[model samples]
Target: MKKTLFFASLMMAAQLNFAQEWKPVGSHILTPWGEKVTAQKPHPEYPRPQLVRTNNWQNLNGLWKYAITPVNTKEIPQQWDGSILVPYAIESALSGVGKEVGKDKALWYTNTVTLDKSVNKNNVLLHFGAVDWQCDVYVNNQLVGRHEGGFDPFTMDVTSYLKKGAKQEIALRVWDPTDDGPQPRGKQVNRPNGIWYTPVTGIWQTVWLESVPKTYIVKTKQTPKLDEGVLAFQATVAGSQAGDEIKVRALNGTQVIKEQVGQPNADFELSVPNLEAWSPSNPKLYDLEIQLLRKGKVIDQARSYFAMRKISMEKDENGIQRMLLNNKFTFQYGPLDQGWWPDGLHTAPTDEALKFDVIKTKEMGFNMIRKHIKVEPARWYRYCDSIGMLVWQDMPSGDLGGNHWDMQPGKISGGNRDKARSQESEGYYRKEWKTIMDVLHNYPSIVIWVPFNEAWGQFKTKEITEWTMANDPSRLVNSASGGNFMETGHILDIHNYPDAAMPDPKIFGANQVLALGEFGGLGLPIDGHSWQQKDNWGYQSFKNKTELLERYKQLIRDLTRLIPMGLSAAVYTQTTDVEVETNGLMTYDRKVVKMPEAELNTAHQALYQAPTK
Candidate 1:
């Protein structure tokens, strides 16, 4: 009887373990990370690292019952199709319900969260790390707020809808048109192929709750001036009184450099002695502590950091333009870094996974990476700063009209005559461009601002470059990369594939730094780890890792020659394979590193020591 009972118990345990492993019911699937996600403790870390608070807060990740509702539906569906892990996209394998909602429907998410007893005081603020397109939030059936921007974070005050000691139901409705609209959707498309991939909709970021006083700090901006050895700050507050005091402290290791007391919403400068400038070779960061005090009591405090560095353009020995880092020419060679994951789409599965790419890039000996058409989490940039990696930030393109022929590499034959954008579109583009600059202007590692890529929705090249320069004179601007070069801006950027070349920087005579904005897409697909078994392609296809490594080595060898020929920077096609594009150094699942680390690292280090003109 004991033996028979033990056998039955063993069978039950095995069944339970199998149930824990989520399975796919259709063609859609979950990411590898998705399968590992658990609702017991989901994305429990503080969402906003920039601005932090010690008030009542709760993470709303975990499992959320979800359904696909009609775009115009006003009532909640009585039946939920299945459960999805919060923060992961619906198309990801982790979401549990791998399905495509497309552009025609609104994806709805509903979850009930109990308010902690301590959070009953004051106003409760709900925050979202990001949402794809348009999203509306409702708490306990009360409409709370809505946001439009897809990439930027947004928040709403949900104090009025809270019931003390009771469970509050939170509902989110999202609508994303992706390529169907002119919004800055990046490289997302309905029918993804080649460069574009599947669309990310609904909540693709962290969702959490925070309790704050009626008045709080909304945001803060810190800018460093290396020449003057000063760091300038501007603080924005929601409920700041005219005479509110803000205490700022700058620390290096355990030593305090400077401290100052200032008024809210006013410019304050703190001086430092013997400042160490930040660069790709030496990224020096000073820690910051900010406190909001009322009547000599600390109401709120947050920690931040900044780097003191400068990026400028200067004439080289050959009278050609070159990019200067701290008054010295530094050749930047790195990957294009599309910032996509086959399983998570825009979101990476883990913080370590995100840092892995930057760490690997640095290990491979490249000092810079062009963040192509995607804005990574702030942590990614922080890692870059800690590891000393330069970043070229691209303002993701939007309104790229469908016409596959236009995107083809050699479809245009010789370069077609550069054309200008319509005045109306140009006006809207400028407005959005300014917003993007203002949002990302504080990062010191971002040395270059790429306004347009291959002329997609590109117009008024000269004017746009001028505007970027005037708005942020601290950084260099690349007018248009690879397409419709107007001989404007501080960088004469080009795009080459599997081959590296440069235009005559002398003929332009603008003293613009030369860079290859895009190149080197060598694809090799691993059978077990691909988005699809067939139809996978890259700029150049290879059959084996040995052959791919050889081709890569040849490309780097050729690029080294271009460094002395006025090449200041080069961005390799990508870091990982996405969907049907199998040209990444790492596989889509991130489980495999295709090439030997030693070989890739050795090849990458050649860029730093390569002789310059």
Candidate 2:
């Protein structure tokens, strides 16, 4: 009876602790597109859309055990500090463990999970959406793998370490040197003040597991050509035997476009008769089904989709470079999406929150968004494709070798050209940059590849531009935007402050496309919607929506004159207000829209229509 009573007491305590875990916040805010993000089912869709798998897959999201420890420690602490929501950064309030982890310390995460019998029969791959800096993974007390790099996804095959039908312990150890080390830590500082806000540590992305056969498909490539009316399909296999046949299928809605048999690693072109081209308007995607077959029997299968579209830069009327979508010039204008949320740092609080940003940006009548310095979940890009928005993906900036103040556009101590040559730094940057590009190269909405932004760790600009051209001849390369315009690439970009400024098309030669890479940081601080209380700032401060709207309109009106002079694209400061940075169309909480929707929509529509001849 004493033992039974002790067990009952322990169960009561467990239930009490479960009740106090991190609960969803900000469920009441109606998104900019009138869609409400509620607590019941926030971000319910599959996070990774690029790679689809269907076998022993389980989402290890919801809640996890977490602790903070010294960098030198290798053992788990006796007690967890508390529960935190996975996929959200530690510095975020929604993560429950709102704390800072410096270079001197490490964050540890532990979780116990029971593996399905099916996963043990084959290979089990453990995947992380992203981790801040460095992470070591262990399954069932055995170290499986380790990964470095915060923003990219990494996986480890954990088949050998599993004990079927028994609970397994998975542990992760992470260390991030935000601004303290020479890594690609973008806009993260130990003491986040001004533009640099909050340092993320540990796993700030979804953790999950999937089961695959002995010989399975690893990666698939989809390249669409609208003019040819064909989609090129290629599959990279892991352990395929000789005489293996792979079947590829393309479906539009419920109708099948084409299906054919092909060998692994070989490109197979599938034709679509009545293909509807993908664009900012009428973005249509055809569903793709892939299967691996042995002796005419299907062994494994996966699903993916692709859109038929092509992006290029060509000389338009009067010999000025313009972005050509489907062989025609379409001016791309949208906000500089920083991809930050009030509750979640790297990960959006909910899938609806992720979709809302794209939807709202579209409602503002913008055709494109320059995703600045951060790669988001694949679903974010999928939503952009669905809702008809173009994307210019920027690799997250890091290794600036100094503080945020040191990396500003016009603040270089010397104009000495020799200082730009850093062979060691350049090598490391190229390695990481290639990894980032290879990972996100499949997404269709991503048009422009920006190698460097404002000369942050920018060395050998001309060579890097040449390499980017050789690597990806399909897309346009903006070697460096805003600062240190080398006048080498297809686009001549400039970044201005509160006021919009356009680069001289004549100075860069008549062939270069003039673009305003960044502008319009109009700040309006809501009473409670702020990361900090004092010293909050923006490019241009305003007390009310009325003043903010008037100034924003006038700025766009000034930009209209530059369009005739060869301005083809313009990206505003940001989509949402980040911590301590109040220059956003919406407040940090995403509860308020700072500008009148109609007025901003009218200004953005000017870009969509061709400039007056």
Candidate 3:
């Protein structure tokens, strides 16, 4: 009887272990980091680095129950379908439920948040890094909040909804229309082909819970003035009384450089005696600490950082406008980064994987990256700030139906330039663009803001450009990247394929900075590293690695000649091959790097020389 009971116990243990195991659902290629992910914990780092509270927080990024119901369903379903990963989208292989949730269907998720007395504080904030399209969140079957953007983070105060028990349930219903709606979804489409890729639904980023005091700092904006040698700091305090105070300190390592005390929601400037300008060669950053006090007693505190750098434009000896960093002319050159992963469609599998691309870009000797049509997580920008890589941020393009593109210089006309969008579409664009700018304002790496790309969803050119300028007078605005050059913004940009070219110095170089937005799409697809076995594509395809390398070298040589003709900056085709687009320096899965980094670094050093008359 004892032997039989022991064998039964072993069998029960084995069954439970098998049930708990998790694996990726699809057969698509995955990055090395994706293979390391487990169901126990996915993104185990702090979600918000800018406003960090180290001790009292929980990372809720494991598995959760998911269901796909019709859009007409009003209430949360009683039974869920199966278990899916919390951060990965339903259409991705990492989610363990690789299925499409279209316009007619709504994706739902349910999870429980346990209230541990040691971790739960006076106030609880539920935060989401991002949710695709539209999402409505509920806590304990009560609606908490609804958010409607694919790229911006949102938070909700769920402290009031806690019950007497130790567990609280969370339900999320997400709806994404992809190309059918007039939202700002960059390159997602229902029928992905060519340049377009797969549709992402539901959560695609980290979700966590944060604990704070009754009166805490909601947000803070720290802007550095390089010319005046001062740092401007402002805090948005929540639940503040008349006598509340905000104390800020700027530190170099453990030593305090400057300290100041001010009222909440008011700006304060602190002076730095010896300020070092942040550049690619020396990316120096100063640590920061902010505390909230009531009558000289500390209530809350958080940690942050900032850098001292500046971006401006000035004319050279030849009367051509040149891009300037810290009042010095420096040539900016890099690839168009798409920010996609084969395993995790919209999100990187790990934080290390996200930083790997930027590290590789720095190793390859590029000094800038034009983040094309997609906004990455906050950590990505932090990596660039510390590693000294300049970023050109692009607003995701949508409502792409009413475009009349004119790419040439002299052929641009007022009639076909800006598309007239509907009132609904226009409202969505304005709100989301402003929110994106507000969220990314503190990062020092972002140097330029791009509004439109090649007339895709371009509308009200002069009005939008003026608004963007007035909103943030600190950085330069590209207005429109490649086409519909209304000559309103600071840059005159153009796109050329397979060859190097620039805007005419005689026509617009005196008034605006000339930039080659895109060029050099040299392609060579590896056999085992491609998305598909056949039908791979690029702007210019090659036979092998040797031919591709020679072609790339010739293209770089051609690009170097144009620098003397007032080309201030240039962007290559891409950083990595996304989907069927094979014109990338690296493979889709990030496994194979076709070109040698040392040779590329050596070749790129020629483009930075001072232009000769």
Instruction: Give per-model CA RMSD.
Output: 5.2, 3.9, 2.9
Best by lDDT: 3
**Candidate 3: misplaced stretches above 4 Å?**
1-21, 409-411, 414-416, 610-612
Write the number of the candidate with greater TM-score, choosing between 1 and 3. Answer: 3
Q: How do the residues 416-490 of candidate 3 rate in per-residue lDDT, one tens digit apiece?
A: 468989999998899899999998998999999999999989999889998998888889999888878886888
Q: TM-score rank, highest first? A: 3, 2, 1
lDDT of model number 2 = 0.77
Compute each candidate's TM-score over C-alphas.
0.90, 0.91, 0.96
lDDT of each: 0.77, 0.77, 0.89
The TM-score obtained by model 1 is 0.90
Which structure is stronger by lDDT: 2 or 3? 3
Between candidates 1 and 2, name the one with more favorable TM-score: 2
After aligning candidate 2 to the native by TM-score, how far in Å is the CA of 21 from where it should be?
3.5
Residue-level lDDT tens digits of model 2 in 22-125: 56444322233223333222354666686687555777775678898889988766688877677777776566667888989989888887665555546788
- Compose the digit string of candidate 1's lDDT tens values, residues 1-613: 9999999999888646534554433453344564565645456766655566655678877678788988887666677777777777787665656688877888888987877765654778888877877888888887787777677667898888876666898998888888776667788888987888888887877888887767677778887777788988877777887668899898998788999988888899988777899886788988888888887788777777888887877877778777888878888888889888766788877666778889877776778989988777666777888889899988777777531223332122234443444554455466556766776766777888988888776655677789898998888888777766765688777787878777665565345677788889999998878888888888999999999999999999998988887788888887888888999988887777788878887887787788876
